[model samples]
Target: MRGNRGAHRGSPDSGSVTDVVVVGGGQAGLAVGYHLRRQGLDFVILDAEAGPGGAWQHMWASLRLFSPADHSSLPGRLMPIQSGHTYPDAAHVVDYLADYEKRYDLPVQHGTRAEAVHRDGDRLLVEADSGAWRAKAVISAAGTWSRPFVPALPGRGVFAGRQLHTVNYRRPADFAGQRVIVVGGGNSGAQIAADLALDGDVDVTWTTQRPPRFLADDIDGRALFDAATARRRALDAGRDDTGGVASLGDIVAVPPVREARDSGRLKASPMFERLDRDGVRWADGTRASADAVIWCTGFRPALTHLAPLGLRGRRGHITTVGTRAADEPRLHLLGYGDWTGPASATLIGVGRPARDAAREIADLLDA
Candidate 1:
C-alpha cells in the first residue's frame, strides 16, 4: 500500500537505513532532501503523491503561481522559462519539481503515504501503508493542506449543493452559471472569489466570521515575519513558553479583500448558524442561497502520525524549531512558521528552515 508510484529504490534487500526520513514530498520535503544531500547525509523523502509536483497538481487548473518563476525553483533545478517570462502557472511549476527530483537524484519514495510517525526510543519510526521506516531523525514536510479545515456547520450533509475544499478545487467549470458562496476570507477566498467574479455568471459571495486584514505591496508579509520572529525570540528569552498557537492575527498578511468588497462579493458574516433546506443562515441574521460552497477556511497541520511523540502546541501544531531542543528535543518542523525574512509559507518560504534543519542534522551526526 505504501510503495512508490513509478520508480522503486531497486531491490528491497538493497534498501539501507537512512540518517533522516522526511514525510510528505512537497516543496519543503524536496528542499530539505536536497540540502541533506549537500550535507552528505543519507536521507529519504516519502511523498503520497504519484509525482514530484506536490500539491500544485491538485490545485485549481487555471491557477498561476502568485510568485515569480525564479522564486519557484527548488534547490537544484532551474525553472524552465519561455521568452524570459514572468510568473509560471501550476503546470510549469509541476514540471520544475520533476526536474528538481531528477537533477538532484533525491531518494524519494513517491506514492508512499506516511500513515504514522512516532518516537521509538531514541530512533523515530515511520509507518506507511506499504512499508515501515526507522530513522535517526524525522522531518515533517507534510505541509498544512494535508488536513483541510471544514468546520462542523449544521445541515452540511443535507445541503442541496456541491461542497468542496480549496484543495480539491480545480477550475470554474463546476461553478459556471451557478450561484456560488465562497466561505472564509483568507487569501484563497479572495483569489477564488476574484477569479469567479471575473469569469462572470458565477455570482460568488465570500463569508467570514471576522474582517480579514489585508496588505498592499506585501506589507503584511513583512509584518508577519517580524511578529513570528519576535515571538520565537520571546520564547528563547524566557518570556513565555506556554505552548500557545501562534495567532493568525500575527502571521496573517492576507491580500486585501478589496476585490471582494469593491465588487460586492464580500460579507462579514459568521459561519453557518443554521443550514436550512433553502440556504444558509449567518449569525448576524443574514441568509444566502448558493449552488456551491468552497471552504477556504484554511487547514490544520496533521501530526496524527507523530502523535506518539507527545509533542504539540496549544492548538496542536508540533511545537519545535530545528529539532525541538527545549521541548521535544531532536524533532524539527519546516513550513510551519511566519519567518522573519523574505520567505512565507510558499515553496520559496520553506528554504530557510530546510537549510537550518539540514545543518543541525549534520551537526548531530558529527557529534
Candidate 2:
C-alpha cells in the first residue's frame, strides 16, 4: 500500500504526481491548505521546520503579537490563549499552529525542505529533501524567514563589533552590559532596543534611515489590518487608494514599547554613514563606539526555490495578479507581502488571498 501510494503520488523517485503542492507550512501556507482542503482538492503542504509554528519557532524569546489572540488567528480556528494572556507570545503562536494543522488534518509534510521548483512538462516539479512532488499547480507561500536582508553598507566588513540580523536575535541577555546599536525603524528595532535597554543595564542606540513612525496610541494590529484590507479593496475596485493613511511600517504601541517611551529610552538617531572598526561613523566624521550591532532590517522573499521557473521580476518577486503569477499562470504566491496580497504577511491578512488562490486553482483544474 505504501509503494502504491508513493507511485500514485509521483514521488521524486517514482515520478508520481499530485494535484497541488503548497510550499511552506507557515501561516500563509496553512491558510492556503485550509482553503484547498475545503475545496476538496488533493494538495500537500511542504514545511522545512522539524516541528510546528513555522517561523514563529525562531522568534526571540520575548516576542509578542501586537494584536490580541483572537484577532491573530489563522483560518478555521481561533488561536487559544491562556486566561489573562491578552497578547499571545511566540510559544503560544507555535502551539496554536501545531494544533491548527492537527485539527484540519492538513497534509503537511514536516521537515520536507523544498530545495527547488521547476517546470516538468505541463506540471510543476517541487524538489524537496525527502522527495519530489509533481503538481498541476504550485503555491509558493514560503514567507521571508529564510532570507534576512542586511543592507550592503560601506565599511561593514571593517566593523570589529559583532553583527547580527533580527533572525539571529534571541534574547536581551545575550548582549548584557554591552553597548549595542539597533538598526532599522521597524517594530523589531524598537522592541529589541527596548528589551536590551531595560533596567538601564545595556547601553543601546537606535538608528533608522528615517524617523520611525508610531501609530496612534489607540490603534493596534487589528486596526492596521482593517486599513490594509480597505486599501486593497479600493484598489481592486479600480478606485484610487492613495489617500494618506497609517501604513504597516508604523510601530504599534505595545506595552514594552510604551514603557520604553515613558522611560525615555525609545529615542532614535539618524542612520550613520558607515560602519567602522569599532562602531558606526557619521558623515560629520564622528564615530560612536559599539560592542555589537543588531540589524532589524527585515527580509526578502525566499524565492530561490522558484528560480528554475524564471518567473521572478526585476524586483526579485514574481509579478502576480492577486495570488496568480502573471508569467506562470499555474504558479501562485501568497503571504510574502502586499504585492502578493494586502498585508498578506500578517496572520490576519493571509486568509482572503489564500482562499482566492485556492479557488482559482480549483477553477483551473476543473477547466
Candidate 3:
C-alpha cells in the first residue's frame, strides 16, 4: 500500500533505514555509491548479483571492452592495466568491479534484488525479496543486461532452428560448422558475428535492419565518451550540437571485428523478411537454410523493480531531470543510457551522472 503523498521523509516500520538506497550494484550503482559516500550519506547498494561484476560475467567469452583499462573505469579507482590485454576482456572487468567493491568497502547488500519502490511521504521504500530498505532517496541504476531484446519477426515461432538471444549465447564453438544467422545492428551483433566468422566452421549470416555502423579503427570507448561529453556540454551551453558518436557509428571495430570485417568473412546481410521452418526468407522470396539464429538485438532498461512507482512514460521511459524522475523527484535513474546522461551506460561515462545524482540527493536530504 502507498505510504504518503508529499515530499516528507517517511519512518517506515519494517525496513532498514538509510539516507539512500541504490537499486543496483553494477557499474552505475557502484558509481553512485562512491559519490554518495563522498557526500557522507548513509546508504546501501542492493545488488542482485550473488557476487560482483554485475552483468559482465554473463557476456560471451571473447567479449572485450571498447576501451583500454585506463579509459574504462568507474569513479575512484583506475582499472589496473592488465599485463597483456590491450582491451580488457569481460573477466578483467569482473575482477576490477569485485576489487572496487572491496577497495572502497562500500556497503553492498549482495544477492538482494529490489522488488519495487513505493513512496512513503518523501522517503522511498525499496522492497526486495531478501528484505526491505527505507531511504530518503532511491537511485535506480539497474542496467539493461538482464532484459535482452529479440525482435518478434514474422514466422519466428515456426522456425525449427535453434533461436536464442544474447543472454543465451556464450561462444561460437557451440555452433560449429552450422549455418547461423546473427541479427542486430550494434556492437553485440557485429562482435558475435565476427566471433562466429572466426570459427571458420560456422556459416554466419549477419543481418541488421539497417547497415551496421562501424566506428573507425582508432575510435574506442574513450573517444566516444569524450565526444559524448563535449556534445552534452555544448547542448547544456545552449550551443548547436554537432559531430559525436552518432557521426562515428555504433559498432567499435575492435581488432577481431576489424579482422573479420576486412577479410570479408563477416560481411553483413540485409535482414531476412521472415523465419521459415528450416531457414530464413528474403523479401524477394530468396531463401537460405540456417541451423541457428542468434539475436544480438540489445536490451531495454531493467526497471521492473521500480514498477510500483508508476513513473514510466510511453515505451517504459521514465522522464527525468538528469537522473531524478520528473514525476517522482525522490527516485533517480542512472546508467540506463543517454536518457539519464550522455554515455551514462559505459564504465567511464557513468561517473558524471552518478556524481550529479548523488549531489542532488545529498542536497535534497539535507534540505
Question: What CA root-mean-square deviation does each model show from the true structure?
Answer: 5.3, 2.9, 4.1
State the lDDT of candidate 2 residue by residue for 50-69, as single tens digits: 88889999999888998899
Task: List candidate 2 segments past 4 Å from native.
Answer: 1-12, 243-249
Give the higher-lDDT candidate: 1 or 3.
3
Local accuracy of candidate 3 as per-residue lDDT tens digits, 150-266: 878999999999999988889988998799999998898999999999989899999999888898889888889988888888888899986668977989999999999999898
Model 1 regions lying over 4 Å from their true place: 1-16, 76-85, 217-272, 323-327, 339-344
Identify the candidate with maximal lDDT.
Answer: 3
lDDT of 3: 0.87
Residue pairs with backbone overlap in model 3: 8-122
lDDT of 2: 0.86
Clashes of 2: 5
How far off is residue 132 in model 1, in Å?
A: 1.7
Candidate 3 Cα errors over 4 Å, as ranges: 1-14
